[model samples]
Target: MSSERPKLPIEAVELYNEFIHGGMSRRAFMTRVQGLAVAGLGATAVIEALMPNYALGQQISKTDDRIKTSYETIPSPKGNGTIKGYFVRPVSADSRSEKPSKLPGILVVHENRGLNPHIEDIARRVALSNFMAFAPDGLTSQGGFPGDDYKGGLLFNKIDKAKMMEDMQAAAEWLKARPDCTGKIGVTGFCYGGSVSNNLAARMGADLAAAVPFYGGVPPDAEIPKIKAAVLVHHGELDKNAAASYPAYDKALTAAGVAHEGYIYPNAVHGFNCDATPERYNKAAADLAWGRTIDWFNKYTRA
Candidate 1:
């Protein structure tokens, strides 16, 4: 029969120190600490640093108090076809006073799930942060409503990449038309959206002040050299889905001679910034990344 036993919080460290001091043989110590979690506890602590606290999972309460803004469905001639986007800008008295007279704009993209709550919330959050953020319905032919279930599964399979770019171009045109907009813009995205941001910065040249891709797949090897904007790429080191190419991406960015910042959180898995995924959420890393994003935009897009 196996019995489960718990060890003191600091016992693991003491056992290692005892080994070093020759007070106990390594074999004897290993047997005694086998089920004591000497290694598992340490691994969990390290994971906690790189990942979000399971305790804080309850702290995130959803609310509809997010800032509101206007959006227009428009046609595009740039890529595949017509593209529609949800646009957000500052509205409150405090925002008008503290924000720049002419603010820069941001293009927010959606994940494979299509234009949903998380994507919309991101756009609203960007507006709240004082920049004009536009989240284009990445799937237009499929559907245009926020949070609506779409017919197609993956965006690339249904929507042509070229057409998506054209649609994005139309959305950018809309932002440029705004009187308060400064004409400088940036692109950022999560998951599949991140991949688009990377590819766009390489494919689309004009008006991009910065590019921030979070846990996105990278573009082709040849496309690496085409990147034009200052890039900030975030990834999960432990992300099985995205980490395979992380090293190659780092090399590509370095070889391309682009000014970029690459962050790979040690134990973080895919979608660390996503509040929906309890396993992948990392509050500390998310906040830090967000702060960096704000500073990056401020540096590139400030009026």
Candidate 2:
């Protein structure tokens, strides 16, 4: 966690997490915050501070000359029919070249709130790392993210989980088949996206080379043996729900002979990798997990 900003109470942060995760209504969340107000911080201030700051979390600018970006809509016959996404790639992978070198493709999945600015920025970061990245909006059928996480969460819940999986599968297949992408592909995601990463590994089989899920849920034991991708799981130590899943997940992977690794960062909480929410972002954990993610992708996807 960054010390530059005022630290928020852990209880309040936990309540906010629960609210965003659909454990409570917005009105209830607000009422609860009012009770947790401390010196120099009112309910309003706490709520505002807990909300994501997209600008501050953006590590790569959309206009940065190093990367090329575009919006693409791909057919998802099994899903909502069509899905839109933010696509990014290194400038060197531009199609204009006589024959651009094909690069590994990365499917960047966002949290429960659709493809928000922070996730778009993550795609840009992946592009700068020498891989082509695509991040699809799960709420595409609902008019996308709506530019507000609270509303986005509501919209996300309305989406059919099975259809959303198909939509992500479509995005991954589309990226893998692109002229500028190598046949190998990897997936990485945060929170809700993290679970998608894990599930995609099991579903895509040979089509997926690697999967890095940050604080995501574990797939069922029966699905474990189907995973062909090398898996890297990241969990925050204090994120009880996700942390508790790690041991069982790790054991299942080992029993299934799946290549995998799991790490629980000390003192971190759920959503620790999301810098957009300063109240919960753990810089040290996020940085370490990110570095390991890149290495895992390079090792598995680039091979």
Candidate 3:
């Protein structure tokens, strides 16, 4: 699909970074980028390259008979109002029980995009793996997910970071304490969600058994010692900032005596694990990273 999207030059990448960091307005960026196309650099191709193809986002379908699903609203004691999310767990085809077999729990955090269909799909995939998965919508206080075209930055800006963290902590603990859970909880996230995973893992410490952060930022070196969960970090070699942070994070993790593993997929860029963006997705890298993530969770979060 991205056959026409040429590899971007350093200049274009810098402009994108500036835009994401809020240093440039969208209008200014677009106007400048149009000049790139005029200059024969394929600017529109660059934007299309970053567009998410929701059709290819999820690995599993919601209607699969192998999984039981529900929408739940749970109270967040963290003063972030109520939390709402999609919950799923695998079921035996032959069993008619309302309650499925007890399994480990996983918190599937979404990208900066709130809890969209992709995340719901991810929850199902986790359930297929025989774990109970719950994906809380951080936009819960703002009425939850805001339909298909919701801009994440809008809801994100309205949220208080501390409140969001507290709410997630509540969600994790709630999932763990469920009668259907084995009490072990794990977390895995991509991009913004990945950064949250790292932050949550450090904050929750031993309470969170495992964390897999896909192309996410690491905590400050000084904060590394606070993390107790066994971590597996997947990074894209072409994501300069993320790639640069790996060695320092690895060193800090080692020094802090944390159990961890890290991988940098060659030639991949940020969001490489997300199959929705054809231009950025690296199937081989995504598959390898996903396998490692599931294996890491199985090893560390098993009952």
**What is candidate 3's lDDT per residue for 137-227, written digit by digit as tens?**
8888877777643366567668887898787878888898999888899999887778878888888888889999988888766778999
Error of 1 at 94 (Å): 9.1
lDDT of each: 0.68, 0.93, 0.80
Task: List the RMSD of every prediction in angstroms.
Answer: 11.7, 2.0, 2.9
lDDT of 1 by residue, 1-303 (tens): 535423333344444334323456546756655646543355444223333232343332233344446666777766646776777776666455755367789989876656666666677777777788889886776666434222223333566767776676677667766677888888889877898788878876555778899988898898888887888988877665576777788888889888788888776656767764444566788878888988888887774
What candidate 1 gets wrong by more than 4 Å, as runs, is 1-66, 92-100, 145-156
Query: So what's the TM-score on candidate 1?
Result: 0.71
Q: Which ten residues in a row have the lowest lDDT in candidate 1?
A: 46-55
Best by the TM-score measure: 2
Q: Residues 143-196, candidate 2, lDDT per residue (tens digit)?
A: 998999999999999999999999999999999999888899999999999999
lDDT of 2 at 274: 89
Ten residues in sequence with the least summed lDDT for candidate 2 = 1-10
As a whole number from 0 to 100, the lDDT of residue 150 in candidate 1 is 27
Predicted structure 2, TM vs. truth: 0.97
* TM-score for each of the candidates: 0.71, 0.97, 0.88
